[model samples]
Target: MKVVIVGGGKTMFFLGRNFAAKGYRVVIINRNMEECEDLAKQLKAVVIFGDGSNAGTLEDAGTASADAVLAITPHDQDNLVICQLAVNRFRVPRAIALANDPDNVKVFEKLGIQAFSTTHIVSSLIEQRATFEEITNLMPLGEGKVNITELVIGSGSPVAGKQLKDICLPDNSLIAVIIRNNQSIVPRGPNELHLNDRVVVITLPENHGKVLKMLTGEE
Candidate 1:
């Protein structure tokens, strides 16, 4: 996969390195020459010095064939423009933007751009930790109609030691993956739910509560 990242800060640095390390062709487009030079030296990906929001700069950065484009600049407007150009003009398959202000997420969403806000994500993490002990992660998808959630199996849970096929998951939900002892497994019907294992599931919004109850056996 080819990924084009627009920005020069910490987000770009980490994402460039991680994606490059994963063998994906990565490219970074930044406005600052010094930051671009620094990133070029530090990361294995290509670093281009230009304004990412500019269509010509993106064209020079090879955004036309990019599998995904991430507009992660601190300025929300710049990110929006970059993502819009990538998705609408360049026809990139995935266009993601970073919302520096949590309040900008709605605008990005309204514009049909995938937005990731660190501030909102961190706040959600803290809130989820406080409110739901069983749910470790909650990613809402399709305008919150569906969710991808992670549930940690407890020792006293009724589903523990039971085969996945034997457990009746809520409608429109299924176990997608299992993380056991740091190993990720594509769960199968014969797989058994073990204590301390983290189970990731794709479930509908209305069924989310039921999924939690079914797994943890707690209200």
Candidate 2:
């Protein structure tokens, strides 16, 4: 697999290193000469010093052969343009952009580009941590439309001691796995939830609160 990363500071360097470590062909494009020099020295990726939003720059970075293109420039417009070019012009299979403005996420999606908002993600994480302390991990999927949450079943949890079949989960939600005694168990209809068991639940973002309430007996 080949990946092209456009614009970023530490993120670009680390992503390039990680992709190279995974044996993927990594290409990084940046306008800053100093950063490009640093990245070229530290990472095993092809580092090109140029504005990634430019078509010629992307071409130089081999975007045409990239399996995935990620545009993470600080400017939302630049990110949008880079992603658009990668998908529409280069025909890359996957094009992801970073939306500096939360409102631009939908705009990017409407233009057929996958996008995520760092601002919205950070705020959501803070809110989730404050509201649901039992949630160990919360991962957003489908661009924050769906969430996979890990919840620790407490003694007061309504689903504790109940079989999966009897627990009434909200629509578009299901308990995917149960981790007990350091072992992971694929949940089944006959499987029963126990106190302190860590459960991985997949649910729509709208049903996050309800899933927590049902599983942890918390609002």
Candidate 3:
């Protein structure tokens, strides 16, 4: 698969190296020609120096045939504009963005941008590891700051049958989505608690245990 990244930062470099090492074609585009040249040389990537939002630049970067486009600039507005161009103008099949602010992630999601805030995600993962030493499949938002955990609610749990609002979630934890019968549901307060439900939760490291007990049968 061909992937294009619109930024030449640490994250971009890491992604390019990993993908290129794994034999995927990668192109890294950046406004700073020096950083672009240095990173491209280090990773053996196809580096393009230009403004990512420009149609000509995108075309020159081979965006037309890219399997995925990632807009990960430090600036949120730039990232959004890049993503919009990739999706709307270039018609890229997949577009992802990097968000500097966690609060902005939801807004991006609402705009149909597949994006995440590295700071928020990483911090939550670190916190999760500190709290739940046994928890695995932590989404690696950071070394341990935030986490995306697949929590299972077994039978006879305290929260079974209780309305979602009644369940005491740690302030740091959020029930982002629920999966039942292979269907994904973005949870709302009106969604009632049910036994044997598997939930995908996003939370800060500190509040994972409380969420675990509520999710699994153990208190």
Taking all chains together, each candidate's TM-score versus the true structure is 0.71, 0.91, 0.66
Q: RMSDs, each prediction?
A: 4.6, 1.8, 8.3
Error of 1 at 194 (Å): 8.7
Worst 10 residues of 2 by lDDT: 8-17
Off by over 4 Å in 2: none
Q: Write the per-residue lDDT of candidate 3 for residues 27-107, one digit (tens) a residue.
A: 888999789779867987889999998888999999999999999888898888888889998899999888887788889
Q: 82-179 in candidate 1: lDDT tens per residue? A: 99999989999999899999888888999899887888667655654565678878887774567798989997578999999999887789999999
Residue 184 CA error for candidate 3 (Å)? 27
lDDT for predicted candidate 2 compared with the true structure? 0.90
Q: What is the lDDT of candidate 1?
A: 0.88
Q: For model 1, which pairs clash?
A: none
Residue 47's lDDT in candidate 2: 91
Q: Rank the candidates by lDDT, best first.
A: 2, 1, 3
Off by over 4 Å in 1: 130-171, 174-210, 217-219
Model 1 quality (TM-score): 0.71
